[model samples]
Target: MTELEADCSRCVGLCCVVPAFGRSADFAIDKPARTPCPHLGGDHLCTIHEVLPERGFRGCTVYDCFGAGQFVVQDLFGGAAPSPAMFDAFEVVERLHELLWYLADARSRPEAAPLHDEVDGLRDRVSAAARSPHDVDVTVLQSRCGALLDEVSGLVRAGGPSLRHADLAGRDLREEDLYAADLRGAVLIGADLRGVDLGPADLLGADLRDARVAGADLSQALFLTRLQVRAAR
Candidate 1:
C-alpha cells in the first residue's frame, strides 16, 4: 500500500487549524479558518484527539486529508507550523492530492495496468506540485487528472456488467458480478451487498443508505460521492 496514508502523527495539526465549522451535530462550537482550535495545545496537538467524538468533534473523525497535512508540514515547509498563507494554500493542495489518490489507486487494478506509466507519471507531477503548491493553478492539474480518468474508464468498463438506473432497493446483491455497472441513481437502501464485485461501478447518485458493505469492494467504483457514503450506515 502507498504510504499515501494520513499519518496525523507526522503533521503539525493543519486540519485542526485550517477548517471552519458552525455548531452542529458534528461540532460543539464554531471555529474560523486559519484560527487555531481552542482544544489545540501549544504543542500543535489536539487535546481531545483520543476522544474527539466524545467531545462532540465528530466531523474530525471522518475528515481525511490523505497525508496532505504532513506533506505540507514536513516536506514543503520543513516541519514548521503553518503561517496563514501556507495554511490556506494547503486546502488547495489537499484537493489535488485527493485526485492523486484515485488515480494512484486505479493503477493497482489489472484493468489499469497498461496505463501504469501514465498514472505514475501524473502522480509524480502532482506530488511535485504539492511540495510548493503556493500560487499554483490547481485547475490545470484537475483537468489533466480528469482526462486520464476519462480514458481509463473505458478500459475499466470492459467486460464488466452495468446496472444503469436499476432499482435494487432492499435487495440482496451479495456476491453479485456488477463490475463497471452504470448504477446511476439506483436506490440501494438497505441492500445486502456483502462480497459484491462492483469494481468500477458507476455509483453516481446511488443511494447506499443502510446498505450492508461488509466484505463489499467498491474501491474501484467510479463517481461514488461522499454524500452517498454518508447516507449509508
Candidate 2:
C-alpha cells in the first residue's frame, strides 16, 4: 500500500472536528468547531461511509488526516478515548493540516518556488512526527506550519507567482483554484483537491496517490490518476 493510505487508515476522524462547516454545497448542515459529525459513530468511523457524497458529506469524503488522527487516537492515547487533552491536540493537528494544504497550494504557484526546499523539509519532519510513537507538541508544530502558510499567503495576496519543483505531501487543497498550474515532480500524497479547477495544469512526475479529488476539473491536467478521474465527479 502507499504511504498515504497507510497513514490515513491510522486516523480517528479528527478532521471532522476542529473545523466549522455550514449547510451549503459542500455540507448538509451547520457544523461547529470541535464537534463530531452526526454521521460519525462513537467508534470514530463515518456511519455513512459508503455514501458520504450522496448524503451531502462530500467534504468528509475528500478529507484526509494523513494518519495524524490515527496516530493521536491510537498511538498517543492508546485508543479512541475522549479527553480534553486529545481534543486540544486534535485542534492543533487540524490547523497544521490546513496550513500544510495552504503551503502546498502556494507551492503550485510560481512565486513559491524558492521555498520548495523548505516545504519539503517541513513535510519530511511532519511525516516523521506522524509516524512517531509519542505525543507531539501541537502548539509548536502549529506555529511552524502557520509561519510557512503566512509567508505563502502574503506572497499570494501580493500577486507574486512562480512555480517550479515543489513538495506537497499530505496537504489539503479541497476546492482550491489551480487552473493551469505547474506542479512538476511534486509530492502530493494525501492532498484533497476536490472540485479544484486544474485546467491546463502540468503535473509531470507528481505523486498523487490517495489524493481526494472528487469534483476536480482536470480536463488538461497532466499525469493524474485514471482511477481518481474515474472515481471523481
Candidate 3:
C-alpha cells in the first residue's frame, strides 16, 4: 500500500468500531459510535471483506482512513491493545493524515515548485499533530492547508473553469474540457464522464458516487482520493 492508503493488516479494526453510520444507500445497518460492526472478526479483519458490497456494505468498500489506522495502531499505541483513548485519537489523526496526503501530493507537482517549501512546512506540522492529536486544533490546520491547496490549484490550473460546489449530478460531461477544472465540492453523483481526461482538476470533497467513469483518465486529477474513485464505476 502507498503512504496514504490504508493497511488493515496493521490495524485493529478501528474504522469498524469508532465511527457510526445509519442505514442508507451506502450502509445496510445502523451502527452506533464506538461499537464494533457485526461483521468484524476476532482477527481484526472484515469477515465479509471479499463480498462487502454484495453483503450490503458498500460504504465500507469505499472508506479510506489514509493509513491512519495502521499509524495509530503501530506508532501511537505501539501495537498495544486498543483503548477508548486510541479510538478518539483515530479520527483526529485521520484528518491530519489526509492533510498530509494533499500536501505531499502538492509538493510533488512540478507546477507547484514555488510553494513546495510551504507545503513541506505544513506537512511537518501535520505530522507532529498526528503524533500528538489531542493538543492540535485540526480545524485551523485544515483551513491553512485548504488555502495553500487552493493557491496551488490556481497555479497548476492556470485558468480552468471555476465550478466549485456546482451540482452536476447525472449530467453528461463527456465533451467538457475538464483539464485543470476547479471542481471542489461538486456534486457529481451518477454523472457521465466516459473517456474524459481530468488532468489536474481539483476534486476535493467531490461526490462521485455511481458516476460513470468508464475509460476516464484521472491519472493526474488533483486531490482525488481512493474513496471517490471506488465510489465511481
Candidate 4:
C-alpha cells in the first residue's frame, strides 16, 4: 500500500497549485484555484513546509494527495511539467486513489473475507479509471465504494456503537470504550481523547483536527488516514 501513500519527493507540488484555499483557521491566506501558492518555490517545493503550522498554513500539512500527484506526473505524463489538463486530471486521480485505499483496507480485514472478491473487482475498476480519469464517473464510483465500505464496516464492527456523523467537537471522551466503534464521519475537533483505545474504530472521514490523542491506541484503527493523524495534536 506504499503506492497509495504520498511521496512528495516524487511529485511536482500539484497540491499547492491546483486547489483553492480560503483563509481560515487552517490556511494563512486565500489562494485561487490553479494558482501556485505564494510559498511554493521554483523547484516545486514548499518554502515554509517545515514551519507551515506556525506560519498559519496548517491546512497544507494535512492535505494528502494519496500519491496521486506523483502517479500523474510519472506514469501519466512521463515526468513532464504539469499543464492545465494535468491539473484537471489530478483531482480525478486523487479521488480514485483514495477509493483504492479504502478498498485495499477492506480487503485486508479477515472479517471482510466474504467480500474480498467484490473488493478486488472494484479496486481493479478504480485502478483502471485512475489511468484514464476523464472516462470515469467518479460520483458513481464513490457511491459504490461507500456502499461496499458500509457492508464491510458492519462485518468488522459487529455490534459496536454507531456514532456516524455525530458532532462531538471539543467534548471529553477519555472514559469511553470506543474500540471497534463505528465513528465514520464523526467530528472530533478539539475533543479530548487521551489514553482512549480506538483500535478497530471506523474513522473514515472523521474530523480529528486538534483532537488530543497523545496516549490513544490507534494501531488498528480502521481506515484512519495519515491526514487525520497529522491534524490531531
Better model by lDDT: candidate 2 vs candidate 4? 4
Tens-digit lDDT track of model 3 for 163-197 = 99999999999999888899999999999999999
lDDT of candidate 2 over 1-233, digit per residue (tens): 12223243456667666577999866888999778878777766778889977988766765555345765777667876667677776655544544454445555656567777877788667655654524667577757865775455444334322343566667777644566566655667677887778765655445666667677777655334333343343
lDDT of 1 by residue, 1-233 (tens): 34456777778788888888889987999999878889988777889989988999877766767677877778877777578766876798788778777676567667778888998999888877887787778889888887786567667777556665678989988757776776757889899988888878867557787788778887878756554665566
Off by over 4 Å in 2: 1-10, 94-232
**Higher-ranked by lDDT: 1 or 3:** 3
lDDT of 1: 0.77
TM-score against native, each model:
0.76, 0.49, 0.98, 0.98
Q: What is the C-alpha lDDT of each candidate?
A: 0.77, 0.60, 0.92, 0.92
Candidate 4: where is the Cα deviation over 4 Å?
Answer: none
Error of 4 at 220 (Å): 1.2
Judge candidate 3 at residue 44 and give its lDDT: 93
lDDT of 4 by residue, 6-62 (tens): 877878899999999899998989999999999999889999989998999989889
Model 3: which ten-residue window has the lowest total lDDT? 1-10
